[model samples]
Target: MNHSSDLISGAATAATGTQTTSPEPPPRRRLSRPERERSIVEGAVKFFAEVGFDGDTRELTRRLNVTQSLLFKYFPNKASLVERVYQEVYVGRWNSYWEEIVADRRTSLQERLVRLYTDYAKTALTWDWVRLFMFSGLRGEAINQRYLGFLRSRILEPVAIELRAELGLPGPDRVPLNIQEIELVWGINARIFYFGQRRWIFNVPLESSVEELVQLTIEHFIAGANVLVPRIVQAQIDAAPAHAD
Candidate 1:
């Protein structure tokens, strides 16, 4: 036989004799129940943000190297898992200090507003927060409504009261806010909220840091409020029907 044929015959004889095989990959290290559960939750945060609440968990489990039973053991159901996500992303993330700092009487309203927005933007303008917020809004989720109501009661109403004070107008309790004035505060808030969307969602590059953005927003709002609030107040006053003809 030729050298090549002899070599092949020798290899076949060796294969037949030993039945050569490749080693299997090492098994994954086992995680404790708590560690595994926490791992799943964190993974869910990223997964849900990417694919939204409607996205399948099957792929999530596959990526997590876990069985569906294991995920369900910790979360019970997909809805319960989503509730935990809401708790972590929204309910738990809220800083009551935002309302407290804005309500602090020592600082000028402009200073207070700037501080509040700057502090808020630091946490609230992030990818997880912004994307989850947009996702909830698009899904018609109740958490978003609850968050809006909280803002209306806590941040916006307080800011509105301060704006009235700035203009020497009566307090909301004493003079009640018109829809227009309430929406003016909403407009300011919407601008800041949308600024995050522009930066994070639309991939707009902002030259300003969060602090600068907050300051710029406050400056424009204060200047515009100084000019327009007076006019708005006057319009309300002028439109008030004269004493019974």
Candidate 2:
């Protein structure tokens, strides 16, 4: 992941009457403002992911082979450029229609969960996305939090509702999510996220293909949910303070 951006050539020194090291210059290219801005941001994503958020903008410009001033013209600063990278990578990649797909009652709950994850893993399980996500997490970046919020509101909540429905329990709109139910769904969701981390970040060998993994995970999840939800709902009911008749 390291790049030539941080390298300094130790060739010569004039004061010592000895050769001084000069880093090799980046290749020159005549790109328009929009084109060059795009290029800088693209390079910055890879550069930041490799060296991290603390990585120098000078190195980033070197990687882009552009003058620092030119990069500033578009981004003003590294933070601004990082914002665009977040927007491009995290926000832009979101499929708005995923909610609809997940909420489609025509599909069985098991089928919906599997399909939702299959679509998610296809796009979000890449090395760049996972690495950037981990990097942002370490930096306490809000973008990753926002993405998680999106997942809860769109993906996780819907699955919870569907899970309850599949077991003939009341929806969240009625009984709402009990602690046990929430934990149940979070456990399932966490396993799916870890699957991506294991595959991409850890480079673990997966015995199941993406499709097989999704199907297997959801099937097991649904099996557990069917048995757990009723017991959880009863526990919640018993825990409620009874009113005097």
Task: Determine which window of 10 residues in candidate 2 has minimal summed lDDT.
Answer: 6-15
At residue 88, give the lDDT of candidate 2. Answer: 82
TM-score, cand. 2 vs. native: 0.81
Q: Who wins the TM-score comparison? A: 2
- CA-only RMSD, every prediction: 5.6, 11.3
lDDT of 2 by residue, 30-49 (tens): 77878877777789889877
Regions more than 4 Å wrong, model 1? 1-34, 230-245
Query: Candidate 2: which stretches are off by over 4 Å?
Result: 1-29, 243-245
lDDT of 2 at 64: 80
Q: Roughly what TM-score does model 1 have, to 2 decimal places?
A: 0.79
Worst-scoring 10-residue span by lDDT in model 1: 170-179
- Model 2: which residue pairs collide? 9-21, 10-21, 11-19, 11-20, 11-21, 12-19, 12-20, 12-21, 13-19, 13-20
Candidate 1 backbone overlaps, count: 0
Clashes per model (N, Cα, C within 3 A): 0, 10
